[model samples]
Target chain A: MAPLRDPALEEISEALHAAPGAETITRLSAIDAVRARILLAIEHRLYAPGEQLPPLEALAEGLDVAPITARRALETLVEDGALVRRRGRGGGTFVAASPPQIQDSAVNVFRADEDAIRLLIDQRCLMESALVAAAAERITVEECDDLEALVDAAEQATTWAAFHSADRRFHRRCAELSGLVEATSYQTTYEMLARYFLPYPLDRLGGSHREHRAIVEALRAGDGSRAATTTREHVGSLRRDMFMALPR
Target chain B: MAPLRDPALEEISEALHAAPGAETITRLSAIDAVRARILLAIEHRLYAPGEQLPPLEALAEGLDVAPITARRALETLVEDGALVRRRGRGGGTFVAASPPQIQDSAVNVFRADEDAIRLLIDQRCLMESALVAAAAERITVEECDDLEALVDAAEQATTWAAFHSADRRFHRRCAELSGLVEATSYQTTYEMLARYFLPYPLDRLGGSHREHRAIVEALRAGDGSRAATTTREHVGSLRRDMFMALPR
Candidate 1:
């Protein structure tokens, strides 16, 4: 494949990392970029999960930032639970074995670009559909039963954050069943971008909860296509119901 | 979502990045890790496409490697066309707008782990099917004709690398039609692992070329399911036909 990045996405990437982008897009600090760089290293596996990083001085120098800048960036990421540091010998700084999903402090990029947002949704629809179908084919009756608990957990969640967290568990469990390592991992990493785009709401919860249950039932019946269809419809609805899709 | 990583995947990430995992895994020096970290920054959007990076001294210290080691790593990546360097004022180090696919000097990691290979293949299948369907929904009659050219480009390729390159152009074009930025980006990055797993050969060229042509036809007819089914079958065949599947 040519690996040609879409022109719009190329701009989004710039907006994400630079201060010189289109007006209205929030500007990021050098420190933010540094933290993002280190986090990217972990997400991309350049810095293995749980591997100790270089000394602060070395890290700061190599990154070409003031030592204070590197130190602060690292500290923020640590606060986000993306990294963990320990004192004494045999410890400097380490990528979290299982890093928490980062909440982007900047969501303006998504808010400002409707066309890019549409593509984002489409891309997600493609991935989520395939993952659900792949998972359906591999999900067993017992696993289907486990997925039900996850579904109910979302429906019963009292808050938007709670529901979103539970909702992801349901999907994550399905992806686990598929055993597609990189596909699943790709989805996981993509969420760092995906999650920040929409502030959660219980506004569409009832309908979404129904779809979740429907997907599980389809999986239980070994109907991969049916599960995939519901998944597509669910994500496709984002075009009508997502933040940008509403009055905004 | 939960973003819970599977234990097997966790191991693969570590294997891909570190030298201390499976005995059969090739060792990566500090310099290799340095190159990877910098590359990850680009892929993760922390560095951004075409963004300028820090001076060599700062870069060397930030990553905690010797200056010479940093220099060599930077040079190799630049030679690979992943980065571009210019001398004098207003020039330092910049990530290439469109970087080339990296060839991992190491494939032993994939060879040694049969299970991970299966998952990687499954992940690709998931992505390809969805991307095909997504493209089908959006593909124009004119675009279908362009896809035909890509199919032929792959078929007429005289070498494995040429065919792979042409073949990727076809897929990348399809993803562009969908506009899913992170999903496409995730796939591009995942290939760093996926591409290295199997050394290219003319072994399965004929069938692959046929599938490529058929997928384009399915798009021409706007038959998303047909396109998706064919994709799944073609990728499924890899589980049976890949090198790991071959009797040693």
Candidate 2:
């Protein structure tokens, strides 16, 4: 019911209003949107564990919403156990010391049948290919070196945990290099969905590393299309591996 | 924080508690999530314009949330001008008569640069290809005939508006035929974003129709891969057209 307060928010609202047959989103919707963004930030580790978020007023101004709206958003996070609000002169809102863990059953979040799983895999293939293509065009030499290092780390990983960590960083770095912040943000969602299919067999590590190496090499060569193609194949291979690993 | 009341709600809560590094989504969060799903249903025309929604109690039972949570969710929509809440024995929440229009600026929802747009297009390419592949494998003769009718309608369309509607139905039908409900649901989000790039020139219609015919042929022949490839090309062409139409 609140009037448009921020110009950016107003622009977004106006766009939604103009969309034919689209339902209107109100200022209250902004509260949810802001909350989701902050939660995503925390989930992605953009806000490190135990890190304090900006004061409510500052967050409100930054998001161009009323202080009450920002406060409500933060309160939702607090209620959700994603954040801890401290009182006293030095106290503020902080990322929870312990955030909720995504259970193995988190795949249930997809509420998807096997067909939907395949569809999700298909989506990932396309999205990752695009990320690699964009990264190939814009990735700096330094970023390329970072990717190489991640691949090398994965190759040497004696434990599946270490290998998986490096593998996630490798893919996430590619998204970051693509210079699409939203895409990078979305990579977290993809990874969360992927957690269910993980703990890939140690035997598959060698093959996976090889695929990662090919992706990095293609990026190093600045061949966008090649990078994209290789990335697609790489994701396809993972999908195959997942299907094989699932219990019959 | 209200305690979980229903056994089902408690089970979900316990699952969240078991998850590591995930935020706990509380009942209030459910309100927002339910609100979003309902809004999406309305936007996708699952809930037709002017149709009264099921009572809050029914909705709550369906979503397995508290009645209050469902009420709050509907109230949020009411505040947002997406729904009308009326009192009296026969009155209920109805979709607003004039739903908010998404302004041309609604593309701002992506908060994306050009790269994000390209990534989105790539995503569509992959998704559509998968849908077509599934459709190719499973499309009944009746469904194929329906698709043919849609193509014919598009071919005969005199205005871009008419053609666009047929085009949308064609794509949606492909997803529906895939028998992946979640994937079909996701198609709405893709379509919402695609709206920003709509209204193909009259000259482009013939070529577009030809592409559609090729897709339908591939489906009729039960050539899944070919259908997939053709669908990908079709989406790619649309992406190209969109890019060309954008102001330099």
Candidate with best TM-score: 1
- Every model's TM-score: 0.46, 0.40
DockQ of each candidate, alpha-carbon based:
0.08, 0.05
Give interface RMSD, every candidate, in order.
Answer: 12.7, 14.7
Q: What tens-digit string does per-residue lDDT give for candidate 1 at B1-248?
A: 12224332233343434332343334467666566656544544445568776667666644556889889988978987889998898988888998765654433333444444454565566667877776777789999888899888888876544676677677777666655433453353245334333323354578988888888888888876678778878777777766566542
lDDT for each residue of candidate 2 in A1-248, tens digit (9 for 90 to 100): 12224332223222222212223312226566466556544555556689777667656654456899879878877887888988998899998988774331212222222333444455666566656766776787888898999999989876555676677778877877876433542463364335234333355567788889999999999876568668767877755655333332
Off by over 4 Å in 1: A1-125, A133-153, A158-169, A172-248, B1-17, B20-119, B197-199
lDDT (10s digit) by residue, model 2, range B14-78: 22212122232122255654665566555545466787776666556544568998798778788
Query: Which segments of model 2 are wrong by more than 4 Å?
Result: A1-122, A125-160, A166-248, B1-113, B243-248
- Model 1 Cα displacement at B117 (Å)? 4.7
lDDT of 1 by residue, A178-215 (tens): 66543543453245234333323355468888998998
DockQ of the two-chain complex in candidate 1: 0.08
Residue B29 error, candidate 2, Å: 27
